[model samples]
Target: MSEEKYTLETVLSVKRWAANLFSFTMTRPSAFRFTAGQFARIGIQVEGELIVRAYSIVSSPFDETLEFFSIVVPEGAFTSQLQYLKPGDQIYLEKIPYGFLTLARYQEPAPHDLWLLATGTGLAPFISMLQDFETWQKYRHIVLAYSVRTQQELAYVDRINEIQNIFGENGAEFCFLPIITRDPFAKLNHRLPKLIESGDLEQEADLKFNVESSHVMLCGNPQMVEDTKEALKCRGLIMNRRGVGNIAVENYW
Candidate 1:
């Protein structure tokens, strides 16, 4: 792999999501630019060694600062160091942005219900998409199907209302369906595949799961993406070849 060109950025804030999860905002260089769904390699220098990992941008490009959600693996190579950062601290941020999960990859001539399925920290890009104007203009009905192992791990809880308001008149078409697997008291307590296969996802979104009428985006866990892809494929959905169908995936794990 090519070495990433790194730059210094000051941490603006850091907040915990759960015991093992946290989010931090950092100063964005005026020259740094990216699509809503792109990612950047960020790390810190210790004893002259530059350690970093790629993370999806959670903040909207329109925002003044950049944000990221991360899970702290106590013994992880990069994350173990990442968890030590605090406000006013500086970290290495790669100058260039990269990823293929942006809305521009959708190859259809007409619009369809944009389905954003995420688990754990995979909800980053979809949150960025909701903040951008292009996603609102492209799909009339936007369903965010977020599944987390626990309810507390669900980041950006307050943003759901703001996202709907961003849709303006079509705000009614925007839906946020949060699924928690271990929470029995929660309304939905199944994984994405079980939910999609059993038709529960469609029932909650109040929309049909048709290949022609919907485009799906998957992110976060690799196994979840794989299982969900099989479920979607059984429903006639396939990965868009040269921008043909509507399924796109990004495996963060």
Candidate 2:
């Protein structure tokens, strides 16, 4: 591993979605540059040592400020210190950005539909992609499927709505599907893979995904990514490798 260039930044805002989920914004340095879907190593001092974790970038590159979404594990060493952050508090960031989940990774023939699947804070990168101009220009239709234990765990609804409206403004087709596995409010109450395997996802999108013209991006839980990848494979979607295939995944593990 390369030595990290730790940059000091200040927290600007914090929004808590649930007991375990939260998001925060920070001061972006003028020299910092990254793609919308990339992640950065963020840290805070605990005791006398530095503890760090990689968080997907929630703010688009075009935005002047920096943002990150995180899940607070009750006993996590990093989150223990991170959860206490306040506005004006200091946070450290690695100068270099990293991640495979980005628009730049999916090259060549534009997909007819771009499916962004996320669970929990996994929605962070997709939010960044949606906020950027390139994503809107790359696909004719965008389907965002965000799954959580309950609808209450769905963070950044207002920001999501704003992006959907922006897509609407451009006369583009955008579908935001919220799947709550623990909620019985809707009949389609299965996990993302099951929903796709059973065709509920296609029903919701009103568009079918063909091998040649459909791109899928997965993030969030590792198991969800693997299982969903298998489900998507049944539909002929291949995982991206060395610049091939139609699926891009963020393996945060």
Model 2 lDDT at residue 56: 95
Model 2: lDDT to the true structure: 0.86
Worst 10 residues of 2 by lDDT: 103-112
User: Please, what is the TM-score per model?
Assistant: 0.95, 0.95
Query: lDDT of each prediction vs. the true structure?
Result: 0.87, 0.86
Tens-digit lDDT string for candidate 1 (46-165): 667878788999999899999999998989888878887799999888899999898888777346788999999999988888888778877878899899988888878888677777
- lDDT (tens digit, per residue) of candidate 2 on 1-253: 2245788999999988888888999999888899888999888888878888899999999998999988888888998678877899998888889887987776643656789999888999999999987688768889999988977797888989998887556745888888889989865578989988999999988988777888889999999999999999999888877766788887666
